[model samples]
Target: MTSDRVPVVVAARRTPIATKGARLAHVTAEHLAAPVIRACVDDARAATGARADIGDVVLGNCMGPGGNIARLAALAAGIDVAVPGMTVDRQCGSGLSAIITAGEAIRAGDDRLQLAGGVESASTAPTRTFAGIAYFRAPFAPSGFPDPEMGPAAQALALRYDIDRHQQDNYAARSHQLAYDAHRLGRFDEEIVAIGDVRVDDGPRAGIPAMLGRFAPLFAPADGELNGTVTAGNSCRISDGAAAVAMVPAGSRGTTPGLALVAAATVGCDPALPGIGPVAAITRALADAGVTLADVAAFEIVEAFAAQTLAVLHLLGLAPDGVADPRVCAQGGALALGHPWGASGAVSVVRLFSRLVRGNAPAGTLGIATAAVGGGMGVAALFKVVR
Candidate 1:
């Protein structure tokens, strides 16, 4: 794709993340996504002073009903019926992947605008069964490859990377505290779309640090010499939420400050160590964007599990503190905001928009949004602030 047709994120918004079986438990995936989509489109229209000629609506979703949820959400959002919709599934990476897909379409010279993002409603997901038997998850790989569950993979990563329980708990605590502080200050107010009574994210809390030792390890080593360090407190809560962005070509930016798509990369790693995928993907993405880790002013990597996040940080040489890093998820992450599987990646981008664009950072400021996907893959997108 040519750089001249770069896709600019003209508007971004997300629903308040609610933990599974909480206030948003009854909301369906389409319903959760529709309002966010509508808000983004409305924001873009308000800026351009004309109705957007929507080319398509792209959404990432996992474990929703079998129908095309993107189409359902687009229609529910009141978009023109002529616009088509597409759904993509890249496990946890789905949201970022969808955004990248829309950006690529714009970069390929599609003059019409695009609406893209992801949504998930784990609380209202349909049960899955195969051949008269129930299954918790579909296989990530063929029988010959290792396909460890997310929790065990995180445990193995923590043990392999020497991330101790204390470090994990401290990181989790920091995430919760940051999110709580940001909310109290109304930092997230501009980006959040209220749904019913859920105007604020319900996952973050202030007292997590004091209660660190209460959680027992959910995954432990069989030898018992080193007990499992992964716990519920440090891991992300399953949630229901959606995040979306309105993308237009650079010429259509119309004096709005936005994140211009710079470069993106998706890569694969060993399935047994899926959390490590970000290290390779981020490296390649930075190289592709002609920048280094030091050049990035903001990092919004999904906090699926503290150990996993710490492992990625340690591998990337960004989190020497282990417990806190001001540049990474400065306002907190999925650990405190709740991880709505498919929506978490897009939430990372929305967070970046809030941090870099909405905050009025100087033009050319660099940021990145990345996520470790299930099945041994990672997706990373490099963005730069533009006015």
Candidate 2:
């Protein structure tokens, strides 16, 4: 029996990665989320030309106080108090999860209009709330579990994948080239929302290899046994940003005939190798979509680190050397465009949408966005442009 597929359409999209915003050395977390929500809501309303009431707000934020960030952001955006809001956490995949949750709600016929997205402010990373807890007093136990830090897990993946520091540096360089090319061609301008004076992703550099050479290994200690290939140069940088997307039922008014989420998959992995989670999630998403790696025209793999991306590519049989089609982030990946944790997944969605629209690729052009989470969790979503 053929199962009915519920359509979740993008009614609006917005991101705040302004050049001026990046120049600010620091900004309060609350301040960051507030303006972003307003900008996104305004854009969504304009795009749809329908001022529909938002039925729900789902936000993803990894580092925040008490997990009420979504509610706070919604309130700050002047959303009606009657609208319910909830915050979620899935490490780096939190943003994508937020979008997925909203879409699922719509698919289930639970709500008509939903606001979903993610935000991060590394400039104001909250201190660990329970540093004095008993968990910290325990002696180190070696069950092969590395520190809970995401970077260390990425380093472990580098070791497992046999990726080298030089290769990582090269990948980072390419990310810069691609990001720069996209910016020059005004590809990002579509989804980018100007806030104050900031416009476009302020952190993407032009030449990443030269920048990588200036940095040292971030996770591996100089004197310790070489643990892995992950490096600051190859991994995403700390950043502050926010992204939001408005979703409605397929037949909803003001729906854009663009990309739509085809399938979403989330998977668990050995916490020791958090970076590899994307491979499992991506595989599931591909299977559900009844497609293969060869069917995609471009990929927007979140570059949490070069090692992690390389590993996922190998698993999908689409490693850089293996596939001939150009990946959207062809210029550079997260290594060049600072990854803002919860915000990165949403950023990937925006980037993918822009590429498909500008390139005018076939409606079948598939795009995938994946992210590695703390504790070996990964999430992926497949999207296809609507003909």
> How do the predictions measure up, each by TM-score?
0.98, 0.87
Over 49-114, each residue of candidate 2 has an lDDT whose tens digit, in order, gives 777677888888877655588888888878889988888888689988998888887777654578
Candidate that scores best on TM-score: 1
Which candidate number has the best lDDT? Answer: 1
**What would the per-residue lDDT of candidate 1 be over residues 1-387, giving only the tens digit for each residue?**
556599999899999999999999999999999999999999998977767699999999988985999999999999889999999999999999999999999988898889999999999998889999988779988899999999999998988888999999999998999999999999999999999888999868888778878998898753466579999999999999999999998887778889998999999999999999889989999998789999999999999999999999999998796755579999999999999999988999999999999999999999999999989999999999998
Query: Which ranges of candidate 1 are over 4 A from the true structure?
Result: 222-226
Q: Root-mean-square deviation of each candidate, in angstroms? A: 1.1, 3.8
Q: List the residue pairs that clash in candidate 2.
A: 18-199, 174-331, 175-331, 175-332, 177-331, 178-331, 179-331
Clashes of each: 0, 7
Q: Against the unseen true structure, what C-alpha lDDT does each candidate score?
A: 0.92, 0.70
**Candidate 1 clash pair list:** none
Which residue ranges in model 2 land beyond 4 Å of their true spot?
A: 1-26, 131-148, 219-228, 253-255, 320-325
